[model samples]
Target: MLLIILGLALWIGAHFLKRLAPDLRARMGNSGKAVLGVMIVLGVVLMIIGYRGAEYVELWPKVQALVGINNLLMVFAFYLYAASGMKTAITRKIRHPQLTAIKTWAVAHLLVNGDLASLVLFGGLLAWAVVQVILVNRADRNWVRPAPVPMSREVMAVVGALVVTGIVMGIHNWLGVQPWG
Candidate 1:
């Protein structure tokens, strides 16, 4: 649990540093970006290790029906994440597609994972995403929505999302976790 908490702290702190202390982040420049990247990666590693090793203290039994819902949400989450990068039509409509995707993904996981460790991991991420969106909106009030892209781009984004989701499911299965329940 300590490691999980530490990881979440590091992840949240590193992300907030840029928003909360813009001057400090700007002063560091590219070096700061590199450091932040490393910190984020390390935080993810710690969270994974901590989550895998932590004892499962079930808060509630997993909802069987939610499993299908979770999977569906995951596909949408992945699509949103991909759309953010591709600047798809949805990007013009959504202010923060990537962050929204994170929230969706976190919520989906939370629905299925009822254990304490899962709660800490997914819930913490969900909180982070929400706070991040708030901070970003506060920082930039005038958001210039991206121009709409061609339909082909939207199709590509959906295809990419499906491929990524399949790969993720494979990885989860490889880790001895059944992604589709």
Candidate 2:
């Protein structure tokens, strides 16, 4: 639990360096980016180790119905994630699609996984993303909406998202939790 918390702190702290400690980050220059990268990687490694080691304390009983909903959310999450990088019609409506996707992923995971570690992981990430979004929006007050692209491009994006989702499921399978049976 300590390791998880430490990891979360390192990860979230590194992420907010620019927003929170801009001068320090500027002083560090490109080396700051390298340092931040190391922090993120170390944080992730720590999270993986700590989460696996932590005792599974269920906060609530598993809600089986939510599993299907989570799966659907994951699909949309992946779609939104992919769409964020693409110039598509969907991007026109969603200013920060990647952050939104992260929120969706956190919520979806939280709905199904009731363990303490899951809460710490997903909930912490959700909170971080929410704060980051707020900071970004506040900093960039003039939100320029994306131009709409062709419907065919949007369709292709969806197809590409689905393919990415399949790959994610495959990785989940390799991790021992087979998303698809």
Best by lDDT: 1
| Model 1, CA-based lDDT | 0.94
Where is model 2 more than 4 Å wrong at Cα?
A: none
Q: For model 2, how does the per-residue alpha-carbon lDDT over 1-181 read when each residue is reduced to its tens digit?
A: 9889999999999999898888999999998899999999999999889988999999988888888888889999988987887777778888889999999999998998899999999899899999999988887889888877778877877898889888988988888875643
Instruction: Report lDDT (Cα) of residue 83, candidate 2.
Output: 85
The TM-score measured for candidate 2 stands at 0.93
C-alpha positional error of residue 89 in candidate 1 after TM-score superposition, expressed in Å:
1.1
Candidate 1: give its CA RMSD in angstroms. Answer: 0.7
lDDT of 1 by residue, 1-181 (tens): 8889889988998999989999999999999988999989889999999999999999999989999999999999999999999999998889999999999999999999999999999999999999999999999899999987789999999999899999999999999999999
Instruction: Point to the candidate with the largest TM-score.
Output: 1
RMSD in Å for all candidates:
0.7, 1.5
Model 1 Cα shift for residue 158 (angstroms): 0.5
Candidate 1 off by > 4 Å: none
Question: What total of clashing residue pairs does each candidate reach?
Answer: 0, 0
